[model samples]
Target: MKPSTPTRLFLLWMLTAPGCGLLLGLDDFEDAGKSTDTVSDTDGRCHIDEDCPSGLHGQAVCDDGTCEYTCAPGFADCSDSPGCETAITEDPEHCGSCRSPCAAHCVDGVCNAPVDIATSASSASACALMEAGDVWCWGLLPNAEGGSRTVPLPERIELPLPALQVAVGGTVFTGPHGLRAHFCALLADGTVRCWGTNQLGQLGLGDTGPHEGAQIPNVNGIREIAAGTDNTCAINAQNQLYCWGPRSTGLIEGDTTPAAPTLIAESVDQVSVASFHACAVMVDRTLKCWGLDFYGSLGLGAGGPTHATTPTSVGHGSNFAEVSCGLTHTCARSSSGVSCWGNNANGQLGLGSRTNYNSPQSLNLFASQTLRAGASHTAAVIAGDVYLWGSNAFKQMGSNDAFDTLLPVRLSLPSVSRLALGERFSCALTAEGRVLCWGANDHAQLGDGTLVSRATAAPVRWR
Candidate 1:
């Protein structure tokens, strides 16, 4: 569905009010001067929900072939009251019930943590780092299916230690025998833990046995971690890089099996893992990439190796703050502008053409604040506005269509603070601490409690 522009106050209400659902066409509430007990369409004319008036006291729907008002989701009529009169879930005066008070903050109809949430996504699942220092996951199960394949909603996960951040990898061919997908957690104590799909040694578990559950590796002093389609990498406090997983084409070099974390480079500031390669930003602000460059993803000059098993310098320009790797391309934010290279068949390069480039190309159009690359698309934040380009087969570009763009298209969303891109979906964390997503929802990865795809940004239901 096309998500409408929401006012600040309405967004606040949605975030704090449990079961509010996504109320549409209710922005002009001035006409609703006084609350009404019930609302009915006297003019017997309506085929869809939108045909009803906007100011109706509750959810407006076609009931019994007539327009009527009902309580929104997560809201209900008081036992003593019926019809349109309602009790909200998070309201302190009606906390989960009529006339109840909350001792703390109300969340999902209950008083709980007041912290802003951080969200992460794997290919088929997404996880949230809650304010209470707990991680909750929702969406499709990695290798398991049916009753065991989906969580459907956010469910708390038991971790041995408090997780500061979490990263999830894709599910396709990620396990020891290519049988499972995985996710990794960076704990508050600077330690690293990983689980699932150890077949390729992505878990760095030393052995591939016990492919399920979490594994706490002795590796310590880690500061940042990133997971890829099948492998994982981390940068320690010392700025050294360590990686583990199956050896595809020397992305990690000589590793043939599930191996312990191996140091790859030093003085690394940030690291990003893609489907078949990885890129890093060094303390000197230079970019380096390794692994398969079948489509010139490494961004090395034409004279450079087709594929570098070891890290190779990208372009001469230093001043890079961060870098992100996609399925077959790489994007980095430099002091000058956003630089992208590699696959352009889907216009992911945002270079205004489908032609690929072997060297870094600057997008001199806008001042990029942040950048994220998906399987066949790229999203960058320019002055708080997100611009998306490349594949939109599932409306991942928030245009509500399947057309591809050779140039960047601004997403109609509020100022974005961060972005996470899945294989065929995209999510943005708003400045207000709310999560919004669009694109494919085959596995409920969009996290709106539905399996329907959205062409525009829609709030992810945390409640």
Candidate 2:
């Protein structure tokens, strides 16, 4: 039954109170699909504020027995939807009025110069490469908050010079090593610098002095950089591979000289590293991999050596465009399609099965522009559509489901230009220059300013 006028007002006030519990039944709320404009107490519309869902537009309320979204004082709703989806105070599309687009861009809802954003992720933290090569980092860090370990928002990080690329990862170690995460930046001048935990020399600074950041001596003209648990590798302009940090032999990188960068290979075009292995794209478009292969992550075939101390060709093709390494698997893209090999536990291989493959198994997905691998998940950008497979324990799949998928599933997002996968989270850069992240946010890695893990894409809020 509809409540009386006085009773409706009281219910609305109670619903808007801070920390007040909702005692209303489900039937009291109106459906989102129902428009509020026609709502009337006698017309079987909404009779009270509780009759409408809160947060429908911003925070909803009942006015004169009619349900509508309530904006803060001086705030105006500009979106043409049933409720106010955008606040005129800061909405770029409705800066001051409905359908009024921002002149330059929108920031915090206000029109300003549109910002360009590029993102990178480590196991627990994330970094954004912004305009003019400035970098901002957030999430969990070793020295954050008296060592309490979580930075909930983005903070500009000072580097010796503007960085072109950044890589972050947590190295797995035992006893005194445990897990130490580190960061590395590739400078515009073609040099590489590193910071954070140096327990295993992941920083590549000659000495393990736990410093803010330091440039690696003698190594210059670097074109690309990739990091794993306790090691860092880079491809020089001359197409040579240089590596530092602790040894994880058979990954084509081991400690022949513990204090300096060691030359691993030459004529390499690109490289990627994860837990205990690494892969590289050769000049001929062929792929090679090394390191622990107990899970067939090397894609060297079941007859190949269990561990390859040197680079071994992956599969029998030279048509690969890129390759990525995960915790216990490897994936690559070719003119034909995407394929993965190694441990399929949790379906990280994305072959529609939990069974591991010793040889390259075609995923039959679309041709990919780029791809990335996480601890137990894989993501790819195929003609702008983002597809994820394998583990969704933390919703890294971005499918809004916690259950794992053995096959590729397209994410509900705009065309993506690039992708990055973390231990239990995923992030992407849309063609529109926006950064969106999802999955685990216990350490605020998703950058929504909340530690809440998201099952769907959330814009990376920048203050």
Candidate 3:
């Protein structure tokens, strides 16, 4: 139900009220799909430096939402505080506060970014990548936020104390030093901590809290972490994978969130979490998944007679280097090329059709090493060229076509060096040191300049 005019006015009036309660209401009222928010933020509105919080040091905020900052090119805190500025420039410690301002991209006092890979459990909680392998998180972390869009990037979280590590067996600890009691760092010590919303036991902490940031309990020796839709998967130094959330239908992304990450029942060198599923590459390059396949995201079967609760092979293929999953579809790549399947309502399957597919469809487009799946679209990078397919209702496909693409369309972005896929938007890193994004500008995730959706792509100067 839409709020009435008087209700909107009431909301605005309460915006100035007391307590963090207002903040909560603001967060709740802001419409869910938004990946970015700029309401009462000091830098919320701006022009030049003086109009900004820190006074003089940021981008202009035209009718559209764009704020330049003093951080490095690809990073901005957007704090805009009186003395500090916005998070784009918030961390005096990193940029203005700390020494590694641009590098750390701190928000508040902790290094962080607001973009989270939303899904079931990891949603409400902030996914934190700690320094020296100590990961921690804070905020409305839900133990059941599920759906994909959980922790997309590592951010610094406000820590009243050092991060506490939760064990696979449900043992909890406080402080980084204590985590070492039964755990060993792995994967160059890349720390990925998850809290808030853990129904499937995705936190691996003996099950507790559906929307609270309680550290998982038991077990030890950990490193990297990835949250699927309803599961949580982690890795140790030996490249071993351990998942526990929604094991049935690959929803085992830890607690109960699908795609959070659960033991796929396979040992692999790598893994990738998708909307309601997850994929992994064995040492020999074999691909496997353990989650929902109603849309054929799990491969093996067309999904439908029903969903599976355990890991399944993705067709006997090899040299499969990478794989990605979306809401109703799945796509992966091998030495031969890319193959995808599942729901094509918006062409998310990338198989060149809007028709639902229960069978595998070869992209037969350009070849690439990286593959990404969006809620209803698919993207892949072949060398430096980016190609996309599927639904374009919100331009999530990155092209100017308002309809779905039966085949892949090569997107030439000379300014782009890297590519990332969001739920409804696609972004890339430019060779000229800039950020280019397009599609579903609704939540301002496009970071372009306006709320208007785009059929083509646009450049976003994050700095």
| Candidate 1 global CA lDDT score | 0.70
| Candidate 2: residue 52 Cα off by (Å) | 42
What is candidate 1's TM-score against the reference? 0.74
Q: Which model scores highest in lDDT?
A: 2
Report the backbone clash tally of model 2: 6
- Superposed Cα deviation of residue 224, candidate 3 (Å): 4.6
Q: For each predicted model, how many residue pairs clash, with residues at least 3 apart or on different chains?
A: 7, 6, 117
What RMSD does model 1 have?
A: 12.7
- Candidate 1 vs candidate 2: the lDDT winner is 2
lDDT, residue 122, model 2:
35
Superposed Cα deviation of residue 136, candidate 2 (Å): 1.2
lDDT per residue (tens digit) for residues 59-133 in model 2? 566677667665443244432333433345555556555565653334444444213332222377777676456
lDDT of 3 by residue, 210-324 (tens): 4334334332355555444444566655667776554443344233333333344536676666546677777788877765666566676643334455556667568887776
Off by over 4 Å in 2: 1-122, 144-148, 171-176, 249-259
lDDT of 2: 0.71
Candidate 3 error regions (>4 Å): 1-191, 196-204, 208-224, 246-263, 301-305, 415-417, 431-433, 447-452, 455-463
Q: Which ten residues in a row have the lowest lDDT in candidate 3?
A: 176-185
